[model samples]
Target: MLINLSKLLSGDQETITEQVTLEMEAFVSSIGTFPVVEKRSFPLKVSKIGADKFLIEGETAVTLDIPCDRCLTPVKVEIPLNISREYDKNTVEEEAEDENLIVGYNLDAEQLIYCEILVNWPMKTLCTEACKGICKKCGANLNHSSCTCDTVELDPRMAKIRDIFNNAK
Candidate 1:
């Protein structure tokens, strides 16, 4: 949703409320393939704070199907988003050091909001804290049960150490 800043830029204070859905599949770069992110629909409230300045506030709830790092299993994670931002027509370099910071001027409001969501995504994903990863010996899943192979066969370098222990016994 593109917010028309005509009134706000003209020094007229007004409040604009909007509801829209944004597809964030393309914004996710950290994850190789875009996890299944449901369309985000939320209420956005924008109020003109000053001439060429505005404040944006909104909340969005989204469900994501992410892969676990340990077992590679799909895990459903819900991301509840609440954000507030201020925008000014003057660029950062053009404004004084004490002036309020500005994000986007010519960009659409929805696009800027979507970008914020992408920045808040988590880097690491885990299905559970106790998730037993794949076995190192035979590549079996340790979560289900232990493998029959001897622990010594897993690493050939340990065979000599095992023989020394047997000789000591």
Candidate 2:
């Protein structure tokens, strides 16, 4: 959704509130793509702070299906986003921040939301804290069922003694 900032920038309106619907089904980034399960229509406030400067603000929550780090199970993770950013029209292209969010004189609502989601993305996602994860040997889901892999730990210092006993046997 693109919002025209002409009125706000033209001094006709000092501030304006525009409601934009988030129409993204998935978020594609450099890391990977995550499916967006839920989002809501929200209003964004655009204010002309000074000459050629504008401030945009809003709040919303987005839920996404992110795979767990340990078990790789898809988990619905809700990420809350607070959008508050200022744009300067006279900024240089190389130095400008969020330059892609501005298309001509219109503000890109979807792009703004994307930036927010990207910044607030969790470093690690888990289905549960006690998730047993997958088996290292047979690649079985430990949380669902146990495997018949080795279940013993021997101290390295006693390895020689244990090996001697094994040869005697």
Candidate 3:
């Protein structure tokens, strides 16, 4: 998925467009294997903006199955991505001050797509908005059903006495 910009860097004002499709499956340390990401084939429009600059824009829809953080349930999520990158013939240091500057003379499109998806990933994933999670007393999943254990409220005044007896052991 690498794009060669030899013609664009040679002062050519002509635009080059391409259609890309990618399927990626990678392992994630904390979350196990990353779910298969299926991206619909779409066109990537590349146009020369300046003699030494080019604008790359495209959009793609992706389907992913990720595990919920709370209950480890498989959640199906769809992500719509619109990406735009600017390629410059000049070195990146020349435009280091610009925050939106993306210097690419020779770049891999798959790497760029992976990075964009990573950036758009949610900070926390849950199966439902109000997931009750697991119970601390009996290690039961509260989302499935309520536990039968009695809910107790300890008296704060007697906490010191309980601590003294606990220390005696």
TM-score of each: 0.66, 0.83, 0.66
What does candidate 3's lDDT look like per residue over 5-80, in tens digits? Answer: 6566675637777786664664243446666556677887777887667787889866677777776677777767
Instruction: For candidate 2, give the lDDT.
Output: 0.86
TM-score of predicted structure 2: 0.83
lDDT tens digits, residue span 19-51, model 2: 889989998887788999999988999999989
Ranking the candidates on lDDT from highest down gives 2, 3, 1
Clashes of 2: 0
CA shift of 73, model 3, Å: 1.7
**RMSD, each candidate, Å?**
5.5, 4.7, 5.8
Clashing pairs in 1: none
Each prediction's Cα lDDT score? 0.63, 0.86, 0.67
Could you give candidate 1's per-residue lDDT for residues 1-169 as a string of tens digits?
5655554555564877777566455445444554545656777777887666677788876667777777677777676667677766664345343133333332365465545656566677788889887776687766777777655454556778888888999
Best by lDDT: 2
Report the CA-based lDDT of candidate 1 relative to the real structure. 0.63
Candidate 3 local Cα displacement, residue 69, angstroms: 3.2
Clashing pairs in 2: none
